[model samples]
Target: MGKIVISSNVTLDGVVQDPDGAEGFALGGWFHRFAGSKDLEDWAARETAELLGVDALLLGRRTSEWFESRLRPGGGAEARVSPEWADRMNSIPKYVVSSTPEPPRWNNTTVLNGDAVKEISELERTVAGEILVYGSYQLVRTLLEQNLADELRLVVFPVVLGTGLRIFDETGGKPLRLVDTRQMGDGLAFHTYEFVRG
Candidate 1:
């Protein structure tokens, strides 16, 4: 079975929406303004390593559009991810959960246009490594609600946007076991949690 890893950079208030300030949210680009020292480099390195290990990606339509525009060749002037991370994003198989197939013209991307949980469940049986997730807030909530997420790796930045779309919003409050926690230099903290299933 494959592990589903939900990775994101969130604020102190759990706001994950438009961290890059793309969606015109009031608190958009909140994540980049944090004045961190060495933590930012470490966080990028860790994400690159994680991407190297993953076999596939599961993304919602919005996130899919973001990645397709940024990660593909000749794109990404705003949020230029590292070349190593970009390689994995472009090379790995991406199963995007969307309402239409006309979008996200990135290579090696497959659109899953039906029930997300059911499709992801079926996908788990076919992959051996990680089914990595990034910036898919609604999908993350569903995964947590249905007890499907295996691990959550959050890079918590030092900022609190008190009123934006939260990552844990409306999530059906599931307990999780802390697998690992570390200081990524500066004030940033990296936390890994595994979903607890009884």
Candidate 2:
């Protein structure tokens, strides 16, 4: 079976909201506030390249909506994606886990409206490469609860948001194994962990 990887950009306090400054929330854009140094950028680039190898990209409803809106014609955040990044994104297959959405506007996107774990499991069994999940906070929570994630790639910035979305919910659980951890020059940290099933 292929691996299911969850990659996210989170603050020191675990807020994974709009880090790109596109969201209207005053405190939504925290990623830019904590600028990382060269070491951090190099680490991020390597991680991103690895994630791009995943056969499919899984997204939550809200994240799918945000991406669609930004990629939409005449959208305000259309400039967010550079030409190279746009091409890279377009090359990957995207699967959006949503209930209300009819269909996504992206060229290579599929709508998954059923049980998240079952669907994801089936995809892993049939897909040829890793399954990557990015930025879908709610979906990530659900996957964690169901023990569907095989690995977690956390890019933690140096700032903290006292009150915002958190990476881990209050679902009582055992500890995860800290597979690896690295500190970057810009105070950014990279942590790789795996759920230690009993």
lDDT of 2: 0.76
For residues 1-198, could you state the per-residue lDDT of candidate 2 as single tens digits?
777889888888888877887777678767766765575466556565765566788888788777667666676544544544455566678888887758777878888898877887787787777788878888888888888888888888888778776778555574688999987665788898887776
Candidate 1: tens digits of C-alpha lDDT, residues 117-162: 8988998889899999998888888888888889999898899878
Number of the top-ranking candidate, with TM-score as the measure: 1
Model 1 ranges off by over 4 Å? 77-79
Instruction: Provide the overall lDDT of each model, using Cα atoms, as 2-decimal numbers.
Output: 0.84, 0.76
Off by over 4 Å in 2: 36-40, 71-82
* Predicted structure with the largest lDDT when compared to the true one: 1
Candidate 1 lowest-lDDT run of ten: 71-80
- Residue pair clashes in candidate 1: 21-29
Go through the candidates in order and give the C-alpha RMSD of each one to the true structure.
Answer: 1.7, 2.6
